[model samples]
Target: MVKGKATLALELPLPEEGTANTKQERAYQAIREAILNGLLQAEDRLPSTRALAQRWGVARGTLESVYERLQLEGYILRQVGSGSRVSAVMPDSYLKAVIDFGVTSTPIGEVPTSNPTESVRSETVHRAQVGMPFVARLANPQLMSPAEWAAHLQRAMARMTPDQMCNAEPQGALALRQQIARYLRNHRGIACQAEHLLITNGIRHAIDLVARVVLQPGDHVVVEDPGYPAVHRIFAEAGASLVYAPIDEQGLDLSSVPEAVHCRLAYVTPAHQSPLGVIMSATRRLELLDWAQRQGGWIIEDDYDSEFNYHRAPLPALKAIDSVQRVVYCGSFNQALFSNLRLGYLMAPPQLHNQILALWHTVGRSVGVSEQLGLAAYMHGPAFLRHLRRARQEYLTLRDIVLDTLQKHAAGRYRISGEHAGFHLILWLTADQDQDLLIEAAAEVGIRLQPLRGYCQQNQLEPAFVLGFAALTRAQAKTASLKLAYLLQA
Candidate 1:
C-alpha cells in the first residue's frame, strides 16, 4: 500500500531526552498520546508500518509488536493490506484511565457510535407507527428470509481471513465495491471501475466529504430549492455559500443558477427530486454537464429513490452522461436495504481517488468490515434484486392506497403531486394554515406529516405536506388518509 499524507497534519511526538523507557515503549507512549490528544482521530489511518518504522529509526519487528499490542488492546485496528486505523469504537473510559494514570492495565470497552444519521432509524420507527411522512422500516430482517440472510452472512464470514476482518480499507471492501460498480453499470448505466467507488456512511457523509474536498470556504454552490433539507445543512457546515435553484416539474431549474456567481459545485437529486418527485429533463442533464465542463465545477448527482420508479424505465443517472468526469454520483442502500443501514457509496473521477480516500480517512470511516462483507455477499447473491423488485411493488400498492383514499375523501380540496415515483407524495392545501399547527393537530390524532416548506432554505413555496406510504400498511393508509382528509377539511 502507498503511504499517503493525511489532510490533517498529525505530528508524532518524539521521546524525551534520557528517558528510561526503551525505543518501543517510547513509541507506544507517543502513539497513545496522539490518540488521547485527538491528533489521531477515530478511523484515521496510521502511516504504513515500513514508513513509520523507518521514520522513527526502529526495527520493523518492534513497530509490528507495538501495533499488535495496540490492536489487542482495542486502541487501533490492523488488517493485512489496509494497514492500521485508530479504533473508531474505542471506549471512553480507556482514554480517561490512560490520561489519569501513567498506565492502564485494563483495556477500554467498545466506544458508542455518535452518528446522527443512525438516530434517524429510531425516529422513522416512531413516525411510521403513527403513519408519518418519510418513514420507512429500517432494514427489517423480516423483509428478507432470515435463513437466507443468515446463510449469506455465514458464507461471507467464512470467506474472510483474519486480516480482512480486522482492518477494512478506507475506500471499502474490494468485493463490495466491485459488486456495486457492476450493479450500477448494469442498472443505472453508470460505467466505472471498483476503484472509482468509496463506501460512505450515507448520502450526507458522501456529500460532506465531496464538499470539503472540492469546495473552499465561501465558494458558491448551486442547490435545489425546497429540496432535501439535509443538503443545505451539510453544505452550510462546510462553509459553502449556497445559491438556491428552484425546481419545477422537470427538476432543478438551471436558469435560476445565478450567472454572476461562479458555482464551484452543484448538489442535485436528478432521478427523483427529493420532495418534488420530478425527473430532470435529458436536455437539462446535458445542460448541467455543459455548465460543469465550462466552469470546471463538479455536479453531485444524488440518485435518491431511483430504484422505486413506478412509471416507465428510470432515467439514466447524470453520471452516465458525464463525459468530462465532472459528475460525482452518490447513492445509498438506506432506501434499498434499510434506512438504518447507513451504507452509501460515491463514484468519482479517477483523479480524485487519492484525495477522496484521504478525505474519507480523515472524516471518519464507517461501515464496519463485517457489515461490508455481509452486504457484499447479499448483493452478490440473488436476494438483493429480488428485494428491490418486491419493495417496488409493495411501495406502489401502499402509495396507491394512500393516494386513492386521499383523493376520494379530500377531492377538489387540495392539489396532489409526486405520484410518478418514490415512497411519498405531496398534498398542496387550498386553505392555507400554519404548517406547525397542522402538524401539531395531526400529531394529536397520531399522524405525522412533513411540511414541504421545511425543505426550503430560501425559496418561498406553497403550503403542502408530504405523506409517506412505504411504511404504512393498507389499513393504516386507509385510516390515516381519511383522518387526514377530514382534518384538512375541518
Candidate 2:
C-alpha cells in the first residue's frame, strides 16, 4: 500500500461506521485540521505511513497510531531517514479564530472567542511599536531597579546549593565565566581566561554559535555594508556566501574585501559601526587584522553598544589587539543591562574552543543557571558599575536631548553620524529628503524611523535614519526631536 512517490494528498473523512469517531479518530482530526488550516505547511511532506494507510482506508497500525499522535503532539517531525515532516516551528502558530458564540453545544471546533484577549492585545501593541525611540533604541527597563533586580535574584536564589540546584553549565556559570573573564581583562583589553568564555543568548546567540562552528557550504562571509541585518540572516542560514563589506570614514572597508573571495568569516562592528556609527580605525584596525591574517579568516567582534560612550575613550577591543588569535569576541548584556537581560559573551579563539564548545553542546544552554547566577551577582557587585554610571548619565542626557533637538529643528536638513557612540544616532537624509516620506512621517507621530536602506546589502549609503535615543524621555527627547524635526522640515 505504501511506496515512495506520493508525499501528500489528504482528503480525510472516515467516521461514519456507527460513529463516536474512529477511523483513527477521523484520521487524527483530518491531520490536525490539515495542520491548523494552512493545509499542512511548515516543511510540508507527509503521506507515507504506508501511504497514509492506503489513503485512509485505514489499518497500517491505524496510520501508525496517527503518526504516533502527531509526533507526540508537537505536530509532526519524525526523522530517522527523514520521513514525516510539518514542524519547522509550529506548536501553535495561530489560526484557530472562529468566534460565533451562539453555543450549539459549542463543539464542532469549539468556539472560544475573545481570541486570546485579542491575541494579547495585538501582541502588546506590536511590542509597544517595536520598543520605540528611533525604534529599538533599547536599554530603558525603566532604568533598572525592580527592587534592585529582586535583590539580585534574592542573592542568586539564596546561594543555590544541593549541587547548584541540579547542575547546568554548558560552558556558562563558572561564576559567570569568572565575571566575563574579569570583564574582558579590565574592560576590553581581552587577555581572556575562564577558558576563553562562551555564555551567550545575545549577539544573536553568538552569531548562531559562530555560524554553526565555522561555516562551510560555500563559505565566504565578510558582511558589514550597512550591516547587522541579523548578521545577514545568520550567514545566510549558515550556507554562507555573503561578502558585502563597505562602511567608511574608517570602519570595515578593508580594501573592499575581494581578493579572490576566500573569506571564511568577518562580521565586525569594531566597537561602534552598526547602523553607520564608524570607529574601526586604528588603521582600519590593522587593516582588519591584516585581512584576518591573510585570509585564514574568522573575526566576529560585535562588541555591541560599547558601553554607551557619549564622546571619547572606548576603542581598544578588536579583541584588544589580537596578535593572531583572529578574534571571535562578541559581548552583550542584552545591550547593557536590560533588553530582558538575555546576557551574552563569546571570546573563543583558542583555536575555536573545542569547535565552539561542540556547537555549544548542540544548542542547549542558551543561558539560564538562574540567569547565570544573577548575572554573576551583578557582575561581582558595585551594582554593575552603579548601573553603568546611572545609565551613562541618562544616556548622556538623552544624547544631548537628541543633539539639541536635531540641531535646533533639523538645520540644513539632516546629517549626523553615530553621535560618538551607541544607543542609536545616524540621521543623514538630505538627498532631497523623502527617505520613505521621512519614515512615514515618523510613523504618524509615534516615531520609529529605522531605514538606512534597511541595512543594505549592496552599498547605497546616505539618505538615512536609525534614530533611537535609548528609550527617550527628556520629555520623550524633546517631543521625539521636535517630531523628527518637523519631519525633516517637511
Best by lDDT: 1
Cα-based TM-score, every candidate: 0.71, 0.35
Give per-residue CA lDDT, model 2, range 231-281, as digits (tens): 677677667667777887767876776576677778888778887888765
Q: lDDT values of the candidates?
A: 0.72, 0.71
lDDT of 1 by residue, 1-490 (tens): 3334342223575587444247776676677557654566678788766777767788878888777656643457888877788773323433343345322122212222233232121212134332344344223333556677678878899989988977777689999999999888767867778988999988888888888887766677788987776677677767666777889865678787755567788999988888787777544565676666556678999997888888644655778656566788999998787777788999887656678889888767878887788889999978999998888887788778878877788788788888878877778888555666777888888777777776766568888877677776667777888888887776
Candidate RMSDs in order:
22.2, 20.7
Error of 2 at 345 (Å): 5.1
Q: Which run of 10 residues does model 1 get worst, by summed lDDT?
A: 116-125
- Give the clashing residue pairs of candidate 1, or none: 89-111
**Count of steric clashes across candidates, in order:** 1, 1
Report the CA-based lDDT of candidate 1 relative to the real structure: 0.72
